[model samples]
Target: MNITFPHLGNTYIAAKVLFEGLGVDYTIPPLSSKKTLEIGCLYSPDDVCLPFKIMIGNYVESIQRGADTVLITGSCGPCRFGEYCELQKKILLSLDKDIKFIVIDEPAKIGIREFLNRLSMVAKDSKLSKAKKIKALSMAVKTINLIDNIEKECRFFAGFEKNKGEFARLLKTVKLEAIEAKGAEKTLKVLEEHYEKLKKIEIDNFKNPIKIGIIGEIYTIIDPLSNMYIEDILMNLGVSTRRTLYPSWWVKNTVLSGLKINFSKIYKESKEYLGLCIGGHARECIGEAILNYKHGFDGLIQIFPVGCMPEIVSKAILPDIERRYGIPILSLVVDEMTGEAGYYTRVEAFLDLIEGRKKLCI
Candidate 1:
């Protein structure tokens, strides 16, 4: 089966590496864009959250490009994300698109045997031996972690860079070039060279730029197109930003959480506010806000698409966190109709507020 999946930041890079290393055919849908969103909205119900719509767009685009199977992860939480696969399948079928869906869900929900059965659909397509298949999976994880690290480094160093735009330029260049590498091994090599390069980027030691922690729905925070590249915007404004959620973190949490052995720190921090995993990343979002505040971030920006139930709950609880910690927090809700100008205005205003607060403290 020719496989395709939704784009989640640097996830496409790792997925490409994994599928190719397995000797399976796959199609990388063009990056998420206005056209993708438009297609998604056209098919999705009006009330579904933005992510579902954008994902639909990705699948449609991939289908047109000759993908017959759509590979997606599933969650059995109270969050709407769990429902995405079922709805997407129906939508595709309604549109007369004959697509196969392989949803990789938790073993508990789908049963361990069923989980393996679902995974085998893709795994069995590979010509490689079982040992090599396992190796390929490991390489894909490493690739994701390395790319996430590079992005984190770039965002944190952007504020202190000796030359304006240097960090951003290097980050953009690395991502673009890494994806073009011939194979998983070459991609890893490219990332390693750039990881060292990122360390050596010139930074002014004394510049204490505004630092903000991004906390919100996992998909919105990680995917640039979903949030209108908010992290890039923060970097351009010379602000250092940190986000705790990444594909690597998600993978780890998903695998181990079923064993009740995941997110010790997040659980500890969020206990006072949201102790339960009420679906989505609401608990994590609440925990992250407090964690960033304790770590002395200037402020926090909480972003999620409109109609996200878990984030809506977190939004209600965040003001209390802001008051308790005395840190400013801005909640930005986005959807297909979000205007770029208004979004940028609010973002800039939030930055200004943080800067003003910093000046007052000084």
Candidate 2:
């Protein structure tokens, strides 16, 4: 049976490796694009969060390419992500798309037990084969996850080195090697190779690496509709950004702690890092930015859904943060109508103002 997973950057990359190792074939969804968004926006409610639109588009396009199944890793939270599988299924069925969805629920802390179950589902037809597959794939997954983490960590500080593309290239190579290799030692070897190669580069052109702290709803941060790929936008505009949240942290800290109502978790890496706000996931945006500012970020950007209630609440107090920190800030609120050109235009303008000050100090 052919299987497929959505194009969620590293998630599917890791899944493709893990699943493929089990003797199952899987295809990743196509890279997300404008036409995908157009299709998604056509079927979605105008006011729903942007992630829903982008993911719907991902599914719509994926099924057209003979993709028989869609993979969904489950979530339990106040965030709308918890219902993505059910909602996406409803949308696909309403459109009469004959796609099948394979929803994979998160494994509990039983560690190896949870992994064993996942392995059995996708690979190993017989009991004996399953046992062997589990041992091999588990080792590979640990290696893959490690390489992925290293690459992600490298992204954090890549700005400190010149030719950020060089680091990006090495990261990709290391990740692919980890996925295809048989042993954890192979993973370690690839990582060491990349590290050695990077040390050779002079990297003297490393920019000032102004720190820009980003905070917002999970959708806006990851989903292009909400932020128009703001992270990339920041990097191109020469702003080295620090984002407080990631899926690992989301799963490890927020999800595992039992879904608390009314936003109680004090996110360690977020801009606010801890605090409250109202509307549009603004509380998170505001809190993350405040913490980031105190931590010495040169600037902060709060991204959120156009109508996100909590973010709307946070925006009200953003001026107070600006006043308190004496640092530059640019908040980008997004919806379907927000265009990429317009977003970058604003970012360029912000970068000009900030970079101008940097030059003045010299």
Candidate 3:
């Protein structure tokens, strides 16, 4: 039961902690890169969204490295992501009939009994006692939340750091160290130590950097490669950025949703614009844009894959928010054919526009 899962931001780190704690064999695929995208493109239907292709690539790459089981979360939303597991499984099985897929879905969608059954598939392979397995799951949850908080702080504080690139450098080092740490306990220690280090870095409290809110498709926004490392690019430019969608946030939202608890404040903000979930995180994107403006961000940037239906809906609605609030918004659509040079150029121009607007107000 050697396990592997596709990358979705820092979820890979949590996956490693979970597998190790469970005392099971697992493989972490190489970070998503040009080669990963190329392999995914080669095997995927040309019309499917970018995430599907990249995931196909991740699974194939892991398969070559001795992973026989793939684990992924299931969604039964209107977005195409809901169908990913079935399609991806068929795609992988065609290549290797012996491969296995375990999709962890909401108990409401798949029934509590079936949900436990799917989970047991992985747990049954673990040599740990039942209590130990539960402990591992708890540790994995803690790992994800801690890492996400660290990343959020680094990105938002990048602009205020007295030394340029300090936050970015520390962020890179923290991820590297966390990955190298032997087990769940050691990995948590590594993150906690660096998190303390992050606080000691000097910053200019009075410095007012161009603050931007990032909103878009979940996978594109969370996965750096999919969005062409837009967050890092913004960090380099000394821009403060905030994004509410993280893997940990997703986990909490899913659990709350299963319990019929409406804990998402974003949904309330989105009610005026898009009151319903039309599949994907479209409503959240709309809500985030409005919320950022209310929070006094200078601008907003929305990134999503080309031909993504939900994001396209959000994109169309964004201009209205821009007009009503008088805040600037930039939308970037990426695909296999997206060029780096042009993408960066547009981002630079958008920053320039926001800077000019700030100066005029001063």
Candidate 4:
């Protein structure tokens, strides 16, 4: 079956690894782009968060490219993510398309068990070499995870803009190179070689750096469009940045939440987010404010769709966080209407204030 997946940051890479490893027929919808966002926006309710648009784009793109099954994960929560796969399913059907979708409910940051099921789904009880497929996928996931870590670091270090977009491009290229190498040992060697090359590229972390925390709806925080390419804007301004949420965290929350366990851990992960239903990812975002203040971050950037209810709820409560924490948060609401000029301007102002303060500290 021709399979499809969305770009929820790392999962995009993981899905790629899964398909490649299993030797299954699949394709990645193009990376989240303006057109992708536009497709998502056109089909989705204006009130929902930007992630909806991103998910739709992947589904639509995949279907157009002759994809049969779209591999989606199930969500359970106040976060609304629990229903995303279902909602996207209806949306696709409404569009009058014939698409087969598999919603895997595997709960873990590793998603090892979940994705393996997809491979097995293709296998369909065929005694034909189950072990080989498992081994290949396992190795692929390991290499991909390693490669993802490097990409994250490169993206983080590339947060400083001394080298142009070279490092970020190299990071993606190296990941693709690893995927193509199709062997664990070759992937490792390529990683080492690239690491050496990237290290030699000069980047001054201290150059007018504005340490900032990215918060808000998960998709916008990770997917560039939903956030208006906020990270690139920050990098160009020489701001040191960190994304607060990732699939790993979500996977952990899913497993623990599924077991109805780890209340303390969840509360500790984001005290601001306690007492929220599964869909209420907003409260968790507030916890980021506290985390940032504790870690000496200069400012915070909150991203969400224009009418995202959960985030609007969080926004209502943010002044208290801003006041209590004494850190400025630049909350940028995203929609199709969000333009580059305004986003850059607000980001520039926020970075300027943070930089000015940093210089004063010295």
Decreasing lDDT order of the candidates: 3, 1, 4, 2
Clashes of each: 0, 21, 0, 12
lDDT of 2 by residue, 1-362 (tens): 56766555455545654565555656666768888889889888777877778888887787777666667776544456667788788888887656666665544533547645664565533334656667646644554445446545555555666665665567667656755665335545665676666567545553567677777776567554457767655555445677756544444443444444434334442344334322234545665676777777777777876766666666677777788668787888887788779888987888787777677862
Name the weakest run of 10 consecutive residues (lDDT summed) in model 3. 122-131
Worst 10 residues of 1 by lDDT: 255-264
lDDT of 1 by residue, 1-362 (tens): 89999998889989988987898999999999999999999999999999999999999999999999999999888888998999999999887657889999888898999998998898778888989998999999999999999998899889999989989998999989888998889988898999998888898999999999999999989988989999998999899999989998898887788786764688799999987879999999998998898898999999999999999999999999988889999999999999999999999998888888899893
TM-score, candidate number 4: 0.83
Q: How much is the lDDT of residue 166 in candidate 4? A: 71
Which ten residues in a row are the worst by lDDT in model 2? 271-280
- What's the CA error at residue 163 for candidate 3, in Å? 1.3
**So what's the TM-score on candidate 2?**
0.75
Superior candidate under TM-score, 1 versus 3: 3
RMSD of 1: 1.1
Structure candidate 3, residue pairs in collision = none
RMSD of each: 1.1, 5.0, 0.9, 4.0
Model 4, residue 158: what's the lDDT?
68
Runs with alpha carbons beyond 4 Å of true place in candidate 3? none
Q: Which stretches of candidate 1 lie over 4 Å from their true place?
A: none
Tell me, by lDDT, which candidate is best: 3
